[model samples]
Target: DEEGQPVAAHIPGLPEGAAITEGEVNIDLIPTHKLIWDFRIGDLRKLGWIIQCDRKSAEWVRDRYGEEAYKKLSGKFGGTRTDGETEFEVNILDSLNSVLYEGVGDKQRVVTPTMRSNDDVQLDADKMIDYYEYWHKPTKSNPTGTFGIMLADQIMEYTPYPIDSYPHGELPYIPANPISVQGSTMGGVVRISQARPIQREINRLNSQIDENCDVMGNAIIMVQRGAKVRHSTLDNGAGNLLEYDGKGEFRP
Candidate 1:
């Protein structure tokens, strides 16, 4: 039922659907308890200690050591220490505050580079799906498809064809006749024209490449800007050249 749907009456020790009443019922008296623990650690050192304590039993060490000693201990627990640990603290706090205050009321949320990359990959996926539909147009039920060969061409634009080498690997090409054998269930017949295994693989690989590029590029940009790795994920929200926004949701 939807949020505003009328409440139904439930009888105790009676069979299901025996007596049902339909109308709005007050549910304000429903017992609800929410438990929220304040786990906000403001300082970087404190944050690191919280993370360390969460993973291992280090209460004794934490209690015995001072702030500086605890930070050293925390570093020892990890395999490596960050060089710009001091600057990282300031950046992380600023980033945290920015995220918390984002998209409040009239304020517009600025997309991060990392977010842009994710959107690009999603757009690529959607385009591939469109291409698949185009290739496999005109099924028994629909009889006519909206998509055409143009979509296939667009998909190829993003997917680079590998150059042939001395030890030549099989050269890949988009199938001219992608769909065949309709209404036949016995054999592995393509339901749609563009539903070929090779095409699907190509689309998958293209998506992976786009995602990797976005992530790697965003990470480099974040490091260059002297932001902490913790806040680097925010880079995804940066502006993207590609106009792909997956389902129109700005995900990080």
Candidate 2:
């Protein structure tokens, strides 16, 4: 039987209270070509690659002009409105029709649309690349393009670099040290103190505490020895607390 297929009947020798359970089987139809195509187009656009044209026209253009040219034209013609933003259909169809039938019988002729002359030129892949390169290093007449190129370059350069390249390392275990002490026994009271060298040290300590200790445990304190103590108090009774007392020592 297949891995997840259920048996027709359970075996009889099993324990009385035990029950046989079948594994769940999940099945789904593969996505259709239309769905895949739409998803791919959306993905490409999100990655700065443009895709446009209705399904039929897109297919025709891709077949005739090549995919590269079609993609370039899509970006170049982005946000253009040809039919009141509802449809891209244009009256240029009449011109194309006229150009096709202009030749009579017994005459061989070729007709091509005068797109550039009519201001209908679509910037294909080659043109877009050329434009970008030229914009980056422009001639005297193309100062505006040069300015735009400089601005784009500066913006990209100045943007904060992503921290993804930094490798994550396991934190080293830090031994806890005392920050303060308050007690009085036979000899006298001794107070100690210390602090984290930096904020990141504190963060590391907190992270370690969270990982190793129970939620309701004694608070872990870290202190450095020979740390200078500023002040202290005695048990239950008031006494003069020394400020910068010579008894406490400061270490680098």
Candidate 3:
């Protein structure tokens, strides 16, 4: 079982509720925001670790694992609710696909997946449970190329990271920029740094141009001293021409 509970004492060949259906398989894609992983300095298989988080409803967990798992997962506030259908978090850890390194006290435990028999046997579709197995890279220790499950990090489940094929067993994430200052690392350029200065200069120049145009664009007329000037003739935009009769200089 997913919770590490024993389903049955003894089994003949395949475990009970193990799905072996031979039809189109359904795959659930997880979002990237919920994923956490170490820096991809080089090859993905050599990286330290990777984690996938999944949000599940209380009813969904109860239906999949059982009532005991639901009670344990949901926090104190969850228990008070009349309806037992709140969302909860679960994490899946995939380390190098084959080897799962778990730290226990001072020592670490390297867990490998268990192998299944090759002989054909009858499969009961009615009692089958839906699950997916990840592709494993064949190593010296684990040459069988199989992935397994382990429990660690409070309640995080250890499983294989899903990939399309063995040739390109890369992590599911893609960085925005391929070029990085550090040759081994991956990142993109900081576009904001270049754009912000140019934007500020453009705004400053526009303000200066507007101030100069405003002073020179207005209309000003000159009138001689002691000469009578009619205010009605200066009506805004009335297009009345003014007549100045003074012989010397005029005041504007």
Candidate 4:
């Protein structure tokens, strides 16, 4: 010992003038408890120190270290994702506008959303089932189908040749063709006879047929089902979208 301080006399390859001295870290004795390193929970868990801390350790860390420091320390033990690729974040002390709030409401409710992607999210036609009657019009490049089931509540991420406009609310082309093995199952085609006056012709008829229900007045129902071409001249002067169902009942 040199003046009650130990010294290394013969270190291998010691420099000629370099003196052996204690570093600032060497001045203090080794710590009894392991050091809780900053921003590293993986290291602490390896040594098995953490147990149930019911705000006891948190209060100690927060009161002395301040809110920012507490947040960092809390994150270290917040746990990891199921995929093990990301760390899960949580806030027990929920606050908004610096006001601490603990009540649970709609924000905490679990929400399930219907998913739809544009033609971009390619769905396999071979994998499609028959229950919902999904169809994707076959194209040369996409040889299979492109359509999927879309409920009223759901909207697609991208419209795949969709006929719906944002404002018009009519998606005329939904990358799908509603079809079955039997074509035009509802009814057969018909052509008006030219033997009558132009006004009395079925295809070119144009007149009002309105009366009270008590009289049961006759009504000429214009039907549009299947691939009926909507020609500018073939309108027959009828209502735009309002049509009749398979049973000839007026449908909105």
- Per-residue accuracy of model 1 over 142-250 as CA lDDT, tens digit each: 3231222222122212221221110111111111322335665522232332345778999999899788767766432213222224442555444323222344543
Arranged by TM-score with the best first, the candidates are 3, 2, 1, 4
Q: Return the TM-score for candidate 2, rounded to 2 decimals.
A: 0.15
Q: Which stretches of candidate 2 lie over 4 Å from their true place?
A: 1-40, 51-86, 89-95, 106-252
Per-residue CA lDDT of candidate 4, range 68-107, in tens? 7545444333221111111111221111223433447724
Candidate 4's C-alpha runs over 4 A off are 1-134, 155-252
How would you encode candidate 3's per-residue C-alpha lDDT over 1-252 as one tens digit per residue?
Answer: 222233232233645666433468565434333335556534454533345443334565558657775455444112112111212121122222345475778676557563442223522211211122233333334333344322222342434433223223333334342343565322233334335689999999988877765656644565554556664556433333344566665423
Candidate that beats the other on TM-score, 2 or 4, i.e. the better one: 2
The per-model lDDT (C-alpha) reads: 0.30, 0.30, 0.40, 0.30
Candidate 2: Cα lDDT at 134: 14
Question: What RMSD value applies to candidate 2?
Answer: 31.0
Candidate 2 lDDT (Cα, whole model)?
A: 0.30
Report the number of the highest-TM-score candidate.
Answer: 3
Backbone clash total, candidate 1:
18
By TM-score, the better pick of 1 and 2 is 2
- Please give the RMSD to the true structure for each candidate, in Å: 34.2, 31.0, 22.0, 32.8
TM-score of 3: 0.28
> Measured by TM-score, how close is model 4 to the native structure?
0.13
* Candidate 1 deviant stretches above 4 angstroms: 1-183, 187-233, 236-252
Query: Residue 128 of model 4: what lDDT?
Result: 17
Query: What's the TM-score of each model vs. the native?
Result: 0.13, 0.15, 0.28, 0.13
